[model samples]
Target: MITVKAPGKLYIAGEYAVVESGFPAIIVALDQFVTATISPSDTFGSIVSKQYQENSIFWRRQGDEMVFDNRDNPFHYILSAISLTENYARETGQALGVYHLGINSELDSADGKKYGLGSSAAVTVATVKALCQFYHLPMDKSKLFKLAAIAHLSVQGNGSLGDIAASVYGGWIAYHSFDRQWLHLQRQQHSLTELLAMDWPDLKIELLTPPADLRLIIGWTGSPASTSHLVDKVAMVKAKQRGEYQTFLQDSKACLKRMVQGFRNGDLATIQTELRQNRQLLQGLGDFSHVTIETPILKKMIQIAETAGAAAKTSGAGGGDCGIVLIDRAIDSTQLLKQWAHEGIQRLNLNVHTVNDDVISKA
Candidate 1:
């Protein structure tokens, strides 16, 4: 059996702006993960996952659209991963074999509640990693990320692939998105193998060593938010306010620069200050789009953390999900977690997952 694990991620900063090419975001991979295990089968293959529900699926991409082999199957990310990996395998002249692939995740609650931990991206990365091992394909971190990003894009069709980057690299890293528009055009003229080998325009990934004194804390609001749904809402209104939106993007870029610098310099105060600025920028974005980026509960979550002398902000799209806080190690977070619990918030115990290697191949 070949097994691979991809860690879930939370955005530290640069949410909406990261979607555009060349904008930077800081993201961390959580200890929670989605694991994919595969083994060769004799007659046929099956893909099964016990997440949300137990099921399996097969699919193919028709140009930019995903065409499900089984219309009732909901696991588009896995199917897309299978399709793309097999394509890459054939392109590399590997003999494909029937395999049974199993996926299990720790990114959700035991009773099946999502915590907005970027499960889709994690699963996609996991599946791709597993298949690469299954085929004995020697893949570097860059190729794995590019392959997973293509599969992920074929399904949901939007967002910064920053979560994919975090899953691929692990630990804390700075990411800039590649232009999907450029990829779209290049797909018309290039082969899958060639595409993976080629340099991506505007895409950047750099590992960062954050301040050792800083500690990460996550608080869940107990209400899940649809990342795709919220991103759609923001995109719809973004065009109507072009000038203001441009300003928001610019400010976001500037804020991310300072925060990244703080990480490099081991300055917790600079990081905290910039995080607060990022929250305000996201709030202004929500105001113009009339999309509630921060709900009452999320706002309360941030306020509580701020009062404790830590910096806090909504993690993802933020209609209702998890909020992240960075506090100095000297400051006790016990009272902070207690206050959140009193307000019905669940404090999640997650650490920054550090990867010894981008992918582990074990049999």
Candidate 2:
């Protein structure tokens, strides 16, 4: 069996601004992961993991097409991944055989909720890699990237593609889709390890979720958003203030530069300050939030985190999933966790694992 593990990613900076402008955003692989285990078969079929009480699904390939046994909406991404893999195989003359697939993912939703931690992207990355191994496709990361991207587009309709890219390649990635390219992506396998090896600079991070008894507090603005939707929304804004957007991009880039430097130097203060400023800059974008800074529960959580000495912002597609908070110093995580629980805020302990460090592969 060929096992492929993909990590869930968190966008540290350059949220909406990276939509079309080729800005640099940093993504780190969290401990949460989805694993795909595939073995050769005369037929083609995939088992969708229902780990964490999520439903398991099965799909099979008929000739050149993949058909799902269950036509539920949750299997949409799996179907999309299968379809994309089949297309890639056909175009590349690589036959994707029938295989027995078992997937196990570490992300815990406890009460059947989504955290927007790139679970879809992880699934796509895992599927693409597993299919590549199954078909013995001799493609490099770039080719794997293409197949995964097609799968992502199939489900997401549109995306920055940063999540999948980071999952596949791992570590600090600057995915600039505007130029139709990836730039300065650290592909070294040990990059994650190297990142984690650095002495964590007195900083604390909290990954929160809702009560295990309750679904994660996922707040929706009653608005469905896609990268395309926001990119189009920002188009008019950009046309009117091209100069301002350009300046924002320039400043944001500088912020990333400084943040990285601070990280390397173990300068916690600089990192904390820069993270806060970065979030402020991101919040300036109109669609960055469903409600104002003071009203929404998510934003309120950010404020509380800040008050408790954290630099925080909503993670991924900000209509709401999880808030990524940058802690200024090490605090009693257990106490903070309890505080959040009492306030009806869910707290998840997240240790952001940067790639290029440990080598974890299931082959």
In model 1, the worst 10-residue window by lDDT is: 67-76
TM-scores, one per candidate: 0.94, 0.70
Give the per-residue Cα lDDT of candidate 1 at 187: 87
lDDT of 2 by residue, 1-363 (tens): 888787888776667655553555656667678888888776556575665335555467899898754322234666677776676566556654777777676654655455556777787788777776776656555555556765665555545677777776665454544332222132133242232233222211222221122111222222222333444456557777777677777887788677666655566676667777787776665433322322266676676666666567766556555666666344534454555566666665555544443323222
Model 1: pairs clashing at backbone N, Cα or C within 3 Å: none
Q: All models: lDDT?
A: 0.90, 0.58
lDDT of 2: 0.58
Instruction: Report the alpha-carbon TM-score of model 1 versus the true structure.
Output: 0.94
Candidate 1 lDDT, tens digit per residue, 1-363?
Answer: 888899999999999999999999999999999999999999989988777465444467999998654322337888999999999999989988999999999998887778999988998999999999998777888999999999988887889999999999999999999999999999889999999999999999999998989999999999988887788888998889999999999999999999999998999999999999999999999999999999999999999999999999999889998999999999988888889999999999999998886345432
Tell me the RMSD of model 2 versus the true structure: 10.2
